[model samples]
Target chain A: MWRGVTGTARMCCLESLTYSACTRTIWSWRSTIREFVTLNVGRFKMPAKEVSS
Target chain B: MNRKQTSISTCFSYERSLEDLFPLISSAGFTHVSLGAKEPHSSYLSVSRRGDLLQLLHDANLRMDSIHGIRLDLPGALSSLTATAEAAAFLDVPVIVVHASSFDFDPSEFDERLEVVLNTCEALAPVAEDTGVRFALENVLPGPATELVRSALERLPSEHFGFCYDSSHDQIGGPKPFTLLDVLGTRLLALHLSDRIRDHVDHVVPGEGFIDWEKLCEEIRHSAYAGPVSLEVLMNFSGFKDQVEFLRQACRQAERLYPLVFGENAAGL
Candidate 1:
């Protein structure tokens, strides 16, 4: 996914990328990046089957 | 030189009754307060209400430092602004904090609005002189308000007109942060010291958010404002439901800030 995106958005699109180097470079924007990830992933979670039946 | 005084805006008491605000601040250890256009203080905006206003302040054992005049009621703010000066005089408040325009205004109408503000203030010059109250136009946001403030300061006389620097607004609303202090160093008569967060969450306690208090303290210390560190802080979003506790926290932060700005003496010599 990061192969296409660029800049902070590219850096923000990863799952295993809480690296110190990334944090150091993007210190001012890491919180927003984290929130973006949290919201995007949280929005697509699937419900358990038969839970309401 | 003396220790810088501390005062909080009455916006924190919007939920409480008008009469209770004075005593509340006094009990919370705040000796002075800046009146706001909050619901509690809405009806008390006149010279006719002077007697009641005085009795309230007198009974509370607190004095008014300033009044946060109309921030957005436009097209007819002349009367309110004039009455605010009258009220300030009656209360012996030295300054009246005002906005350049409403919080949300059209960018296209900048000049028109600016002209309106200037004309209204031009009309208030006589009232300001008569009441001996200085109208301090506060910096609201970075764009037009900033420009308006600069123009107003340049055009108006420093005797009856001045500038107010709000810390949160300076931090968030800017072409660049904290440049107004350097740009216009004169007539800094009032302050709205508060903190700000990224999502436009402002008026939080001084230390609760991301404002650099030490830097701000140093800035003001080097400036010409030798008056109260008047905090235009609010409590609705500060997580403190108890107003007294909120005031205490603000006062404690202010105590720490005073030394940073003025050293151990509480005033720069």
Candidate 2:
């Protein structure tokens, strides 16, 4: 019974770790996209859109 | 061919400031631009003062070829065109391309809108004469709108009134009973050159659509228009994401079209 309990605790810890890793990945992706736009489009100070044209 | 024969519209860069747009146009090898798409140019209009826009164009080494005017059938069109003429005269731009208000092309409605169109021409005549900025009524739609435009141009005085052919707009409705170039050829002053992808999705780059540039050049050769091959393209259907790249491509395409437009005999406008 104690082994079963330990296993459940381990699973929960693994799931928490996965969730944290996903959050970090998402943040990294957001920053990468922001940087890309700044370096390319924003470099020329362009609109990057038709913007109702 | 003269480099002055090549011009691009400011409509492609409406999102950018007027100051930013001129340099981009210059960098793209265009010596002239059609003042189009109201925004950044309207900002210049709001100021009662003049010479600022002229100075901006001078700095960029560009000239204003034409300005697109508001729909003449709309309310306050006279004042709007007057303001445009005032601006054009101040900037030394010679032509203003005016649109017919309605897109509905049913022939039955021609009678109804006929008076409105003629009145617009009459109203604008004084402004054109005074400002010395010619008004070129552009063909919006084929059926009733074309009739109205034809009637106005026929009945009006040609000294200040003329025709601005928009190839994209004419490409719609398949073919009209009388060709625009056939009927309005003699009075052509300015041109808004672009290709149509579909019915209403227009202003794509030339040679990227179904328009036969070769045949068009033949027809335009007979017309009275002797100005630049001013393009009114937008990046909307061009599949170009970068403004500078789009401008360069447009300039290249316009150059390709120059031989087609000017022919082997005289060179470009």
Candidate 3:
């Protein structure tokens, strides 16, 4: 299961990889980016056991 | 020159029985009379009972003009006003004359005491007003007599409240060469008329002392106040006959100047 997941992610990265070194510039794409992170995690400890009589 | 107006106050000639003194005072031609409601330094001739006093004034055909209560400096000063009003109402008197409380007249102390006096008047004015009697504060303390009276009038601005302008007290404890006409001209409700000599020692006849009775009458007329000018001289020391003579003379002087000094129909003058 881990091998297949890692192989697909490596193929996607190899397919999109590119290097530009020519003096002529390619079409330059400008993009504005905004970022936010949401988190939801909770934990509650058990109430102490009642003392036995 | 205005004719002087005079009335009589029963002090020295006041005896155990008003019946004993009524004839003498009425015979002396006194149309108005004042009763010393309190005991003088020492005198069994007390008019402590109010009913007897009322009957006496009614029988004599004399108007009970004022009831003089002394010892303002004593504890319970307000009680004295109450007692005085009680006696005055019993006698159907329209006015009551009181002296400045002999308590320390220090500006600060006077301010404190005056507050108490004003509070006293606040409680007493309605009582007097209801009975149709007025409380006239007379000046005797050694301060600006007019200012003292002014402070009092300012404190209690009621018609039932006024001043009994005492010339003798003014000459003695108050400002020298005192003329109430200049200071409390209109607020003068009555006159505690007596002559003063050398620091309030002798209650002499009107003209006997340095006080200008002529000027006093002139001011009273000018002020347009028609209150009684009750002569408050002691008869015991002067001899009843001499006192009567002085009183008669005062009346004569008053009548001679009444029309001129006081307008015609001087109802209470």
Candidate 4:
């Protein structure tokens, strides 16, 4: 019974760590995507550069 | 052509696969041409940067009447104006026509937008002055009145900057063409001539439309305008034979009507 409790606790801890890492990775990816979209939006709104042919 | 011919500025509509429009104008007694290049489509072959247009004008014994209708909103807009002006200057066209603002904004917002446009024009004035090219600001439907046009004129008084009086825009605003002409007469440098039904935005050929052509000719003669009277026509009208013949007749009518309305000595007057 003690082994079962300890194993269950260990498994929960591993699952929590895995879930936390995934959340962190997802959060970073979301931020990175946000930054990219923001930069592009800013570029498009600004006046285009002059190109002389 | 028995009579001396005036220049016909081609609108972007002429590129409707009717490639012979220019040649038709040349054959139909036009002595000069003004080519319009809309923004975003400036690189489009019809209005592209190639000097082929200028070359065509040269070969046809026609002088250029400046590149007409370049908006100030596009990327490199000022530079495009500058480049077109440089080309026009080289070709000795002397004037470039552009709208003060495209699309109508609210009257409440006009003052703010006018300030922006005026300030920008102030900045561009030096470039135009330096380059020896006149920048003509035309009136739009919701555009400034003769008063605003004059105020802008007073603020930025450069020889290379002036007003282009477009009859249709003024008529669209419900002003009598003669009164509008009289109001803008002093500052007017170029004329965009077309007949339109008052309160209707259609470009009916001169004399066919309800425009008082008699009064228009009278005003031009009275003002002693030596500049070209550019016929503003819809580009993709059907019946080439009809369009060509109508334009030629309009030219004749304008010539005949000019002397009679303004007096025979008006040309020299």
DockQ each: 0.01, 0.05, 0.00, 0.01
Question: Each candidate's lDDT (Cα)?
Answer: 0.73, 0.79, 0.61, 0.61
In model 1, the runs with Cα more than 4 Å from the true position are: A1-53, B1-4, B39-42, B71-73, B173-176, B267-269
Kindly give the number of clashing pairs for every candidate. Answer: 0, 0, 6, 1
Runs with alpha carbons beyond 4 Å of true place in candidate 2? A1-53, B1-4, B47-49, B173-178, B265-269
Give the per-residue lDDT of model 2 (tens digit) for B72-124.
88898888889888888888999988876565556877776778878877888
Off by over 4 Å in 4: A1-53, B1-3, B16-19, B39-50, B73-75, B142-150, B173-177, B235-241, B257-269
Model 2, residue B248: C-alpha shift (Å): 0.6
lDDT of 1 by residue, B25-60 (tens): 777666678777552354657556778878888998
Q: What is the TM-score of chain A alone in each candidate?
A: 0.29, 0.61, 0.33, 0.75
- The docking category that best describes candidate 3 is incorrect
lDDT of 3 by residue, B163-234 (tens): 777666566543355555566667777776766555434455565566666776677767636656667665
Return the clash pairs for model 1, or none.
Answer: none
Evaluated at residue B267, the lDDT of candidate 2 is 51
Each model's Cα RMSD:
14.7, 9.0, 30.3, 11.9
In model 2, residue pairs whose N, Cα or C atoms come closer than 3 Å (at least 3 residues apart or on different chains), thus clashing, are none
lDDT per residue for candidate 4 within B197-217, as digits (tens), equals 544443445665566777777
- The residue-by-residue lDDT of candidate 1 on A1-53, one tens digit each, is 56556665766755336675676778758877888888899566664221000
- Measured with C-alpha atoms, the lDDT of residue B18 in candidate 1 is 53
TM-score of chain B for predicted candidate 2: 0.91
Q: In model 3, what lDDT does residue B174 have?
A: 33
